[model samples]
Target: MAQLALDDYPDRYHLSNELHARPFPELTAPCRAAHLAIKQPRDAADRDRGRDFAHLVALLDRHGAPRPAPGANHYSGPLGRGFLKWEMHTEFVTYTIFADGVSQRPFSGEVFSLFPADWLAEAPGLVVTSCLVRVEVAGPDLEDRLGREVLSWFVPESLAVSQVVDAEAVVAADFRIDENGHCRVAVFARPGIGARRLGRIVQRMLEIETYKSMALLTLPTSRGVAQAVARLDGELSGVVAAMAEGGGQENKTLDQLLRMSAEIAQLSTASAFRFGAAGAYEAIVTQRIEVLREERIGGRQLLGEFMTRRFDPAMRTCRSARERLEELSSRAERAANLLRTRVDVENQAQNTEVLRQMSARAAMQLRLQETVEGLSVVAIGYYAVSLGTYLLGPVVEPVGIDKAHLSGLLVLPTLLGVWLMVRRVRARLDHGATH
Candidate 1:
């Protein structure tokens, strides 16, 4: 199994895709040209040029842009949502435009005027807002003309001396412009814009994205759980129907039917339990989704407030659904346990009745055996007495004794012996049975 370390997760980047359609080619060009101009030192003797160069380097470092290599004239960093580092030099600015992991192209264009030191002195705190503006002009070469026109906003005086650059060039200029032009200019940054503030802005943007993705995951899970619950409910109905349609009330068949019914009941109970679990899960997911939605919306609002400075409406909704779901889960558990207990009690009662019936039948069989034994003794005693009587008749005839009176005497003794033997056997059997 491949394991992903926590540190290996990629940082999410959030940039609106629609912003790409705007004329970014007209925006980054002049910034690159200004960056180059500061490095080349047009006046090596001038202390101001050196100072401007140092300031430009500081700005680039603050923005996390790469420094030019030793004896190298230019450098570039990943730009526009792929690391997002835009370069501003004396001559021109170059920044890469990216969409879906692939770079559309590198946009490079020339700068018209460098921001003077006085401008920084006037506005101590400034924020950079890069806006991609779109325009249309009538001509076969309309796009090229529009690019030039947009670039002119940075350097209105240099249009006559400028060279026609590539069609897909990026122009970099400050948001500030002289009021004497048709194009609107905005200042990109003021003197006091610091790294810490930029980091906070980036963090807020990331938070917004995180909450949005969490919402997406949660809502779907809730829907899936709800669907599962519905399916289980249908299954439970079928189990109930099966149990109802089977045989009734004949003990042997009823026992089998009841067992089957119990099994179906167990299944139904299981389904109900699952349904409740799924419902609870769904409720949890819904609550999470709602919370995430609120977070996403709030984070976005905060980001907007940070960027534009405004208040957003407060979002507050109670989670009654979640509470209801928990209650439902508890109820389902109780219901299932109750059903199980009832089934167990019924099965135990049935078993007890079966044992009772067996015991009664065995007792009756023992009584019948005792009765048969007593009758056997009576029959045996009568036959023995008759044999004695016949034998005595012959013997007494030789002695001149009455045979009939001798037979009567033998019958009394035989009957008494049979009665005593039967009584003893019955008593023994009764004692054994009691033990």
Candidate 2:
């Protein structure tokens, strides 16, 4: 029988297909784009997943936009005269709205007007980052255009402008919000630049912004928990100090330490995801900047350099907070162990005292039992002698013997016999007990 190569691994098809998912949108030059990332409250992970799907459907239905298949993670298609792309990620969803041409006034709020105001208000999540991108054909005046018009609108110190993709395009952004509370990116591409290349450039920019925003989400978390972490550390230090002092309410101290440990553990569990997600997102932000392989434009700082100076510090703060949490947790654990050891030693001492008392009582009971046993023998001998005297009287009277003398002689023998018998019974009892 012909055997097929071992049946493909159950997820082989799905796993391989994932790489092709969310392919970059094909775009033409002279396009104005609006990108938005929306995130629910921190508790969104537990919210109904259907809500996201429903929201996507509502937007698609509005413009007669083609519906994505059920359980689709991404979609790109026509929205009126332009195109729209939607992608769902682990923590949030992204929407990119593309138009055919650049707005006359750069970074105008008009691009966002494409999404009906009512529809936006009904979004399940609030906007985390919204950016207006101005894409135009490249010309010899690229540097002049930026120095004359764009540079004035952005902060001189923070602006990052770079030429990328073999210098076919120059991209610049200040990473700062404008008067309308939206960031702006200007992309000037040479005429012959392929649509796919332009699309890749745009995609990278959006990703940089999205992941950067997500990474920053952990910053507030870090700050909020900073004081609590410090307090716990101080308390833990006190506990350890008291432990070192070698006395004074070790149990109480242990209780306090354990309580603090519990709190720290709970905090760690609560923030674990945010910290981990931040680390991942930060890495992505760094990678996205690297892949751009940027070169300086007109002595402007490269994107990589800008992020190093400006964005890197924020990420470092997040790292520091996470490290502090870990250190505090470890300290709490060590303190708890020391306190438990103290409690165990104290308990052992108490048990030893209890045993000593038990031994003393047992000895006393043994002495009292011996005295009772001696009295029992004497009583038994006395009863035996009285009976013997009565029986011997008749025999003595017949022979004219002295009954009193016989009784006296019998008393010693009776006492000896009763004592011997009592000892034998006690010996047997002791032997049985030993067995």
- Give me the runs in candidate 1 sitting further than 4 Å from their true place: 1-201, 230-333, 344-367, 390-400, 426-435
lDDT by residue (1-435, candidate 2, tens digit) is 997778898999899999998788777889989998988986765666667778888988988988989988788888876788988888888889888887777777677876888988988898889988888998878778888877776788888899998888889888887778788888888889999999999989988988998888999999867878988888888778888988679878888987898899898999889999999999999988888888887888888988899888988988888899999898788888978887899899999999999999999999998898788878887788788878888888778667687778788899899889888998999999999
- Encode model 1's per-residue lDDT on 1-435: one tens digit a residue: 876655533432223532442222222211221211112212222233334434445544654666654432233443322233233322223222222211122122112122334533432122222222221112345335435644555553322111111111111222232343212211121123333332222222222322222222233333444454455445444444543454332244334444544544544453443343434433443343232222121112222322122111111001222233344444444444544565667789999999999999999998998788778877988897888888778887777678678877788789888888888977998899999
lDDT of candidate 1 at residue 238, scale 0 to 100? 49
Give all candidate RMSDs, comma-separated: 20.8, 2.4
How much is the lDDT of residue 104 in candidate 2? Answer: 73
lDDT value for model 1: 0.38
Worst 10 residues of 2 by lDDT: 42-51
Q: After TM-score superposition, what is the CA distance of residue 98 in candidate 1 from its true location, in Å? A: 14
Task: Give Cα distance to truth, residue 425, candidate 2, Å.
Answer: 4.0
Candidate 2's TM-score: 0.93
Error of 1 at 307 (Å): 17
